[model samples]
Target: MTKPRGRGRPKGGTDSRSRILAAAIEEFGERGYEGATIRSIAARAGVDSALVHHYFGTKADLFADAADVPLRPDVVVPIILSGPRDEVGERIVRYVLESFERDDVRRRGVMLLRTAVGGKVGSPLIIGFLTRELLPRVARRLDVPDAELRAELVASQIAGMLMIRYVLGVKPIADAPIDELVARVGPTIQRYLFD
Candidate 1:
Protein backbone atom coordinates (compact mmCIF):
# COMPACT_ATOMS: atom_id res chain seq x y z
CA MET A 1 0.00 0.00 0.00
CA THR A 2 1.37 3.42 -0.96
CA LYS A 3 -0.46 4.84 2.10
CA PRO A 4 -0.62 8.56 0.97
CA ARG A 5 2.04 10.56 2.72
CA GLY A 6 0.65 12.83 5.46
CA ARG A 7 3.19 12.53 8.21
CA GLY A 8 4.64 16.04 8.25
CA ARG A 9 1.82 18.46 7.46
CA PRO A 10 -0.61 18.09 10.37
CA LYS A 11 0.28 18.41 14.02
CA GLY A 12 3.47 19.81 12.59
CA GLY A 13 3.43 16.98 10.03
CA THR A 14 1.53 14.04 11.49
CA ASP A 15 -1.37 13.08 9.17
CA SER A 16 -0.85 14.14 5.57
CA ARG A 17 -2.41 11.03 4.08
CA SER A 18 -5.74 11.71 5.73
CA ARG A 19 -5.57 15.34 4.77
CA ILE A 20 -4.97 14.40 1.13
CA LEU A 21 -7.82 11.90 1.18
CA ALA A 22 -10.19 14.48 2.58
CA ALA A 23 -9.12 16.92 -0.07
CA ALA A 24 -9.51 14.30 -2.78
CA ILE A 25 -13.07 13.57 -1.70
CA GLU A 26 -13.94 17.23 -1.95
CA GLU A 27 -12.35 17.56 -5.38
CA PHE A 28 -13.95 14.42 -6.74
CA GLY A 29 -17.29 15.31 -5.22
CA GLU A 30 -17.29 18.75 -6.75
CA ARG A 31 -15.77 17.95 -10.12
CA GLY A 32 -17.28 14.51 -10.80
CA TYR A 33 -15.00 11.48 -10.80
CA GLU A 34 -13.89 11.92 -14.39
CA GLY A 35 -13.44 15.62 -14.04
CA ALA A 36 -11.40 15.09 -10.94
CA THR A 37 -7.82 14.30 -11.87
CA ILE A 38 -4.55 13.38 -10.16
CA ARG A 39 -3.05 16.74 -11.02
CA SER A 40 -6.09 18.41 -9.56
CA ILE A 41 -5.96 16.34 -6.39
CA ALA A 42 -2.29 17.12 -6.02
CA ALA A 43 -2.94 20.78 -6.75
CA ARG A 44 -5.64 20.76 -4.07
CA ALA A 45 -3.39 18.89 -1.62
CA GLY A 46 -0.59 21.41 -2.13
CA VAL A 47 1.68 18.43 -2.71
CA ASP A 48 3.41 16.76 -5.60
CA SER A 49 1.35 14.55 -7.91
CA ALA A 50 3.95 11.91 -7.29
CA LEU A 51 3.02 11.99 -3.63
CA VAL A 52 -0.57 11.24 -4.53
CA HIS A 53 0.59 8.28 -6.57
CA HIS A 54 2.89 7.24 -3.74
CA TYR A 55 0.01 6.97 -1.32
CA PHE A 56 -2.61 5.65 -3.72
CA GLY A 57 -1.51 3.23 -6.42
CA THR A 58 -3.85 4.76 -8.99
CA LYS A 59 -6.80 7.11 -9.22
CA ALA A 60 -8.99 4.10 -8.51
CA ASP A 61 -7.21 3.35 -5.27
CA LEU A 62 -7.48 6.96 -4.15
CA PHE A 63 -11.18 7.06 -5.03
CA ALA A 64 -11.88 3.92 -3.01
CA ASP A 65 -10.09 5.18 0.08
CA ALA A 66 -11.48 8.70 -0.23
CA ALA A 67 -15.01 7.35 -0.49
CA ASP A 68 -14.48 6.29 3.14
CA VAL A 69 -15.47 2.75 2.36
CA PRO A 70 -13.98 -0.08 4.45
CA LEU A 71 -11.09 -0.18 1.87
CA ARG A 72 -9.95 -3.83 1.81
CA PRO A 73 -11.96 -6.51 0.03
CA ASP A 74 -11.68 -8.62 3.18
CA VAL A 75 -12.95 -5.80 5.36
CA VAL A 76 -15.88 -4.76 3.15
CA VAL A 77 -17.00 -8.22 2.03
CA PRO A 78 -17.72 -9.22 5.62
CA ILE A 79 -19.89 -6.20 6.33
CA ILE A 80 -22.12 -6.90 3.34
CA LEU A 81 -22.37 -10.59 4.24
CA SER A 82 -22.92 -9.95 7.96
CA GLY A 83 -26.49 -8.72 7.51
CA PRO A 84 -29.65 -10.83 7.58
CA ARG A 85 -30.55 -12.63 4.38
CA ASP A 86 -34.18 -11.56 4.22
CA GLU A 87 -33.77 -7.95 5.33
CA VAL A 88 -30.95 -7.25 2.94
CA GLY A 89 -32.83 -4.49 1.21
CA GLU A 90 -33.56 -2.67 4.42
CA ARG A 91 -30.01 -3.19 5.56
CA ILE A 92 -28.54 -1.99 2.29
CA VAL A 93 -30.88 0.98 2.15
CA ARG A 94 -30.10 2.05 5.68
CA TYR A 95 -26.42 1.60 5.16
CA VAL A 96 -26.46 3.79 2.04
CA LEU A 97 -28.83 6.36 3.48
CA GLU A 98 -26.61 6.72 6.49
CA SER A 99 -23.57 7.02 4.27
CA PHE A 100 -25.22 9.74 2.19
CA GLU A 101 -25.99 11.55 5.42
CA ARG A 102 -22.32 11.54 6.29
CA ASP A 103 -20.09 14.56 5.65
CA ASP A 104 -17.52 12.33 3.98
CA VAL A 105 -19.65 10.32 1.59
CA ARG A 106 -22.68 12.54 1.13
CA ARG A 107 -21.27 14.40 -1.81
CA ARG A 108 -19.27 11.53 -3.26
CA GLY A 109 -22.35 9.30 -3.43
CA VAL A 110 -24.23 12.11 -5.05
CA MET A 111 -21.38 12.89 -7.41
CA LEU A 112 -21.03 9.23 -8.29
CA LEU A 113 -24.42 9.21 -9.99
CA ARG A 114 -24.01 12.57 -11.62
CA THR A 115 -20.70 11.53 -13.13
CA ALA A 116 -22.08 8.12 -13.98
CA VAL A 117 -24.80 9.66 -16.09
CA GLY A 118 -22.53 10.53 -19.01
CA GLY A 119 -18.86 10.87 -18.18
CA LYS A 120 -16.40 8.15 -19.08
CA VAL A 121 -13.25 8.71 -17.05
CA GLY A 122 -13.82 7.31 -13.59
CA SER A 123 -16.64 4.86 -14.16
CA PRO A 124 -14.31 1.92 -14.20
CA LEU A 125 -13.18 2.44 -10.61
CA ILE A 126 -16.70 2.71 -9.27
CA ILE A 127 -17.82 -0.25 -11.35
CA GLY A 128 -14.82 -2.24 -10.22
CA PHE A 129 -15.62 -1.51 -6.61
CA LEU A 130 -19.15 -2.74 -7.08
CA THR A 131 -18.14 -5.90 -8.92
CA ARG A 132 -15.20 -6.69 -6.69
CA GLU A 133 -16.56 -5.78 -3.28
CA LEU A 134 -20.33 -5.37 -3.30
CA LEU A 135 -21.33 -8.02 -5.82
CA PRO A 136 -19.03 -10.73 -4.53
CA ARG A 137 -20.28 -10.30 -1.00
CA VAL A 138 -23.90 -10.45 -2.05
CA ALA A 139 -23.14 -13.38 -4.35
CA ARG A 140 -21.62 -15.40 -1.52
CA ARG A 141 -24.80 -15.11 0.54
CA LEU A 142 -27.14 -15.63 -2.39
CA ASP A 143 -27.77 -19.15 -3.66
CA VAL A 144 -28.80 -17.96 -7.11
CA PRO A 145 -26.34 -18.31 -9.96
CA ASP A 146 -27.07 -14.83 -11.30
CA ALA A 147 -26.38 -13.30 -7.92
CA GLU A 148 -23.89 -10.88 -9.43
CA LEU A 149 -26.36 -9.47 -11.92
CA ARG A 150 -29.02 -9.30 -9.23
CA ALA A 151 -26.73 -7.42 -6.92
CA GLU A 152 -25.83 -4.95 -9.66
CA LEU A 153 -29.48 -4.40 -10.50
CA VAL A 154 -30.37 -3.90 -6.87
CA ALA A 155 -27.57 -1.39 -6.50
CA SER A 156 -28.61 0.45 -9.65
CA GLN A 157 -32.13 1.06 -8.34
CA ILE A 158 -30.85 2.18 -4.97
CA ALA A 159 -28.18 4.40 -6.47
CA GLY A 160 -30.61 5.95 -8.93
CA MET A 161 -33.07 6.72 -6.17
CA LEU A 162 -30.43 8.41 -4.10
CA MET A 163 -29.25 10.49 -7.03
CA ILE A 164 -32.73 11.59 -7.98
CA ARG A 165 -34.00 12.15 -4.47
CA TYR A 166 -31.02 13.50 -2.65
CA VAL A 167 -28.70 14.85 -5.33
CA LEU A 168 -31.00 16.00 -8.09
CA GLY A 169 -33.62 17.19 -5.58
CA VAL A 170 -36.35 15.08 -7.12
CA LYS A 171 -39.52 15.63 -5.11
CA PRO A 172 -41.60 13.05 -3.25
CA ILE A 173 -38.91 10.45 -3.44
CA ALA A 174 -36.51 12.71 -1.59
CA ASP A 175 -38.99 13.23 1.19
CA ALA A 176 -39.68 9.54 1.64
CA PRO A 177 -38.39 8.09 4.88
CA ILE A 178 -36.44 4.90 5.36
CA ASP A 179 -39.41 2.58 5.86
CA GLU A 180 -41.40 4.06 3.04
CA LEU A 181 -38.42 4.01 0.76
CA VAL A 182 -37.80 0.37 1.55
CA ALA A 183 -41.47 -0.52 1.22
CA ARG A 184 -41.63 1.01 -2.20
CA VAL A 185 -38.42 -0.59 -3.40
CA GLY A 186 -37.88 -3.69 -1.29
CA PRO A 187 -40.06 -6.27 -3.02
CA THR A 188 -38.21 -5.81 -6.27
CA ILE A 189 -34.99 -6.32 -4.41
CA GLN A 190 -36.34 -9.27 -2.45
CA ARG A 191 -37.39 -10.97 -5.66
CA TYR A 192 -33.86 -10.66 -6.94
CA LEU A 193 -32.64 -12.71 -4.05
CA PHE A 194 -35.11 -15.62 -4.32
CA ASP A 195 -36.86 -15.47 -7.68
Candidate 2:
Protein backbone atom coordinates (compact mmCIF):
# COMPACT_ATOMS: atom_id res chain seq x y z
CA MET A 1 0.00 0.00 0.00
CA THR A 2 1.13 3.55 -0.79
CA LYS A 3 1.92 5.99 2.03
CA PRO A 4 -0.89 8.45 2.85
CA ARG A 5 -0.56 11.97 1.39
CA GLY A 6 -0.14 14.88 3.72
CA ARG A 7 -3.16 17.04 4.59
CA GLY A 8 -3.57 20.72 3.57
CA ARG A 9 -1.02 22.44 1.26
CA PRO A 10 1.69 20.50 -0.49
CA LYS A 11 4.43 22.21 1.59
CA GLY A 12 3.10 21.92 5.11
CA GLY A 13 -0.19 23.75 5.75
CA THR A 14 0.78 27.17 4.30
CA ASP A 15 0.36 28.41 0.76
CA SER A 16 3.91 29.33 -0.13
CA ARG A 17 3.15 31.91 -2.80
CA SER A 18 0.60 33.76 -0.72
CA ARG A 19 2.83 33.63 2.33
CA ILE A 20 5.72 34.96 0.30
CA LEU A 21 3.64 37.83 -1.02
CA ALA A 22 2.40 38.74 2.44
CA ALA A 23 5.92 38.63 3.77
CA ALA A 24 7.15 40.68 0.86
CA ILE A 25 4.59 43.39 1.53
CA GLU A 26 5.33 43.47 5.23
CA GLU A 27 9.09 43.58 4.64
CA PHE A 28 8.80 46.23 1.95
CA GLY A 29 6.49 48.24 4.19
CA GLU A 30 8.84 48.07 7.12
CA ARG A 31 12.19 48.18 5.36
CA GLY A 32 11.25 49.91 2.11
CA TYR A 33 11.96 48.51 -1.33
CA GLU A 34 15.66 49.28 -1.28
CA GLY A 35 16.17 47.69 2.10
CA ALA A 36 13.90 44.68 1.61
CA THR A 37 15.66 41.51 0.51
CA ILE A 38 14.46 38.19 -0.83
CA ARG A 39 16.20 36.37 1.96
CA SER A 40 14.45 38.49 4.57
CA ILE A 41 11.08 38.00 2.93
CA ALA A 42 11.70 34.27 2.69
CA ALA A 43 12.65 34.13 6.35
CA ARG A 44 9.46 35.95 7.24
CA ALA A 45 7.45 33.63 5.00
CA GLY A 46 9.01 30.53 6.49
CA VAL A 47 10.42 29.44 3.14
CA ASP A 48 13.84 29.13 1.61
CA SER A 49 15.27 32.22 -0.07
CA ALA A 50 15.47 30.21 -3.27
CA LEU A 51 11.72 29.95 -3.16
CA VAL A 52 11.45 33.69 -3.61
CA HIS A 53 13.71 33.53 -6.64
CA HIS A 54 11.71 30.59 -7.93
CA TYR A 55 8.50 32.55 -7.55
CA PHE A 56 9.73 35.96 -8.72
CA GLY A 57 12.79 36.32 -10.88
CA THR A 58 13.82 39.78 -9.76
CA LYS A 59 13.40 42.17 -6.87
CA ALA A 60 11.57 44.70 -9.04
CA ASP A 61 9.12 42.07 -10.21
CA LEU A 62 8.59 41.02 -6.62
CA PHE A 63 7.95 44.60 -5.61
CA ALA A 64 5.41 45.03 -8.40
CA ASP A 65 3.56 41.90 -7.40
CA ALA A 66 3.69 42.79 -3.72
CA ALA A 67 2.31 46.25 -4.44
CA ASP A 68 -0.64 44.80 -6.34
CA VAL A 69 -1.69 48.24 -7.48
CA PRO A 70 -5.13 48.40 -9.07
CA LEU A 71 -4.24 51.10 -11.56
CA ARG A 72 -1.00 49.98 -13.02
CA PRO A 73 0.88 52.60 -15.02
CA ASP A 74 1.43 50.22 -17.92
CA VAL A 75 -2.30 49.67 -18.35
CA VAL A 76 -3.39 53.24 -17.66
CA VAL A 77 -0.78 54.98 -19.78
CA PRO A 78 -1.97 53.33 -22.97
CA ILE A 79 -5.60 54.05 -22.23
CA ILE A 80 -4.82 57.71 -21.59
CA LEU A 81 -2.74 57.94 -24.76
CA SER A 82 -5.44 56.34 -26.89
CA GLY A 83 -7.80 59.23 -26.23
CA PRO A 84 -7.69 62.79 -27.58
CA ARG A 85 -4.63 64.71 -26.42
CA ASP A 86 -6.71 67.48 -24.92
CA GLU A 87 -8.68 65.00 -22.83
CA VAL A 88 -5.68 63.01 -21.64
CA GLY A 89 -5.42 64.77 -18.31
CA GLU A 90 -9.06 64.39 -17.45
CA ARG A 91 -9.02 60.76 -18.47
CA ILE A 92 -5.97 60.08 -16.33
CA VAL A 93 -7.54 61.75 -13.30
CA ARG A 94 -10.84 59.98 -13.81
CA TYR A 95 -9.11 56.64 -14.19
CA VAL A 96 -7.08 57.12 -11.04
CA LEU A 97 -10.10 58.16 -8.99
CA GLU A 98 -12.24 55.37 -10.37
CA SER A 99 -9.56 52.81 -9.65
CA PHE A 100 -9.08 54.04 -6.10
CA GLU A 101 -12.81 53.79 -5.45
CA ARG A 102 -12.50 50.04 -5.16
CA ASP A 103 -11.92 49.07 -1.54
CA ASP A 104 -9.29 46.44 -2.22
CA VAL A 105 -7.31 48.62 -4.57
CA ARG A 106 -7.56 51.62 -2.32
CA ARG A 107 -6.39 49.59 0.66
CA ARG A 108 -3.40 48.26 -1.22
CA GLY A 109 -2.56 51.70 -2.59
CA VAL A 110 -2.81 53.32 0.80
CA MET A 111 -0.57 50.70 2.35
CA LEU A 112 2.00 51.10 -0.38
CA LEU A 113 1.90 54.87 -0.08
CA ARG A 114 2.30 54.70 3.67
CA THR A 115 5.29 52.44 3.33
CA ALA A 116 6.71 54.64 0.60
CA VAL A 117 6.45 57.74 2.76
CA GLY A 118 7.72 56.06 5.87
CA GLY A 119 11.40 55.95 5.07
CA LYS A 120 14.18 57.32 2.91
CA VAL A 121 14.54 54.10 0.94
CA GLY A 122 10.86 53.59 0.16
CA SER A 123 10.22 57.09 -1.19
CA PRO A 124 12.82 56.80 -3.91
CA LEU A 125 11.42 53.50 -5.11
CA ILE A 126 7.95 54.98 -5.41
CA ILE A 127 9.23 58.12 -7.12
CA GLY A 128 11.49 56.20 -9.46
CA PHE A 129 8.72 53.83 -10.45
CA LEU A 130 6.45 56.75 -11.31
CA THR A 131 9.05 58.90 -13.03
CA ARG A 132 10.81 56.11 -14.84
CA GLU A 133 7.84 54.03 -15.93
CA LEU A 134 4.58 56.00 -15.99
CA LEU A 135 5.41 59.66 -16.58
CA PRO A 136 7.87 59.14 -19.43
CA ARG A 137 5.44 56.98 -21.33
CA VAL A 138 2.69 59.55 -21.03
CA ALA A 139 5.10 62.33 -21.96
CA ARG A 140 6.33 60.45 -25.02
CA ARG A 141 2.76 60.01 -26.15
CA LEU A 142 2.00 63.68 -25.54
CA ASP A 143 4.90 64.50 -27.88
CA VAL A 144 5.07 68.05 -26.62
CA PRO A 145 8.12 70.30 -26.30
CA ASP A 146 8.15 70.11 -22.50
CA ALA A 147 6.59 66.71 -22.21
CA GLU A 148 8.84 65.70 -19.33
CA LEU A 149 8.08 68.80 -17.37
CA ARG A 150 4.37 68.41 -18.01
CA ALA A 151 4.46 64.83 -16.86
CA GLU A 152 6.28 65.77 -13.67
CA LEU A 153 3.74 68.49 -12.98
CA VAL A 154 0.90 66.10 -13.54
CA ALA A 155 2.55 63.58 -11.20
CA SER A 156 2.86 66.19 -8.50
CA GLN A 157 -0.80 67.01 -8.70
CA ILE A 158 -1.88 63.40 -8.63
CA ALA A 159 0.47 62.57 -5.78
CA GLY A 160 -0.83 65.49 -3.77
CA MET A 161 -4.41 64.45 -4.28
CA LEU A 162 -3.59 60.88 -3.33
CA MET A 163 -1.82 61.97 -0.15
CA ILE A 164 -4.53 64.32 0.97
CA ARG A 165 -7.47 62.15 0.17
CA TYR A 166 -6.20 58.70 0.91
CA VAL A 167 -3.04 58.92 2.98
CA LEU A 168 -3.75 61.78 5.32
CA GLY A 169 -7.52 61.32 5.26
CA VAL A 170 -8.06 65.04 5.17
CA LYS A 171 -11.67 65.84 5.98
CA PRO A 172 -13.04 67.88 3.07
CA ILE A 173 -11.03 66.37 0.27
CA ALA A 174 -11.26 62.82 1.59
CA ASP A 175 -14.98 63.11 2.24
CA ALA A 176 -15.77 64.71 -1.11
CA PRO A 177 -17.53 62.64 -3.73
CA ILE A 178 -15.53 61.20 -6.60
CA ASP A 179 -17.45 63.19 -9.21
CA GLU A 180 -16.75 66.39 -7.33
CA LEU A 181 -13.02 65.67 -7.19
CA VAL A 182 -12.92 64.72 -10.86
CA ALA A 183 -14.63 67.96 -11.80
CA ARG A 184 -12.38 70.06 -9.61
CA VAL A 185 -9.04 68.39 -10.36
CA GLY A 186 -9.62 67.27 -13.93
CA PRO A 187 -9.28 70.69 -15.51
CA THR A 188 -5.91 71.40 -13.92
CA ILE A 189 -4.56 68.00 -14.93
CA GLN A 190 -5.83 68.59 -18.47
CA ARG A 191 -4.03 71.91 -18.60
CA TYR A 192 -0.84 70.25 -17.38
CA LEU A 193 -1.00 67.57 -20.04
CA PHE A 194 -2.16 69.80 -22.90
CA ASP A 195 -1.54 73.46 -22.10
Clashes of each: 6, 0
Model 2 Cα lDDT, one tens digit per residue, 92-166: 788888888876667667658876787664577678887788878887888678999998898889988998998
- Residue 155's lDDT within candidate 1 is 79
Once superposed on the true structure, which residue ranges of model 1 sit more than 4 Å away at CA? 1-20, 34-68, 71-85, 114-118
lDDT of candidate model 2 versus the reference: 0.78
User: For this target, which candidate reaches the highest TM-score against the unseen true structure?
Assistant: 2
Worst 10 residues of 1 by lDDT: 5-14
Model 1, span 21-136: residue lDDT tens: 87787787778777788999887877778878888879878876776554365665568547777776666677667667776567666656655553675576577778777778
User: Which parts of model 2 are misplaced by more than 4 Å?
Assistant: 1-65, 68-71
Q: So what's the TM-score on candidate 1? A: 0.67
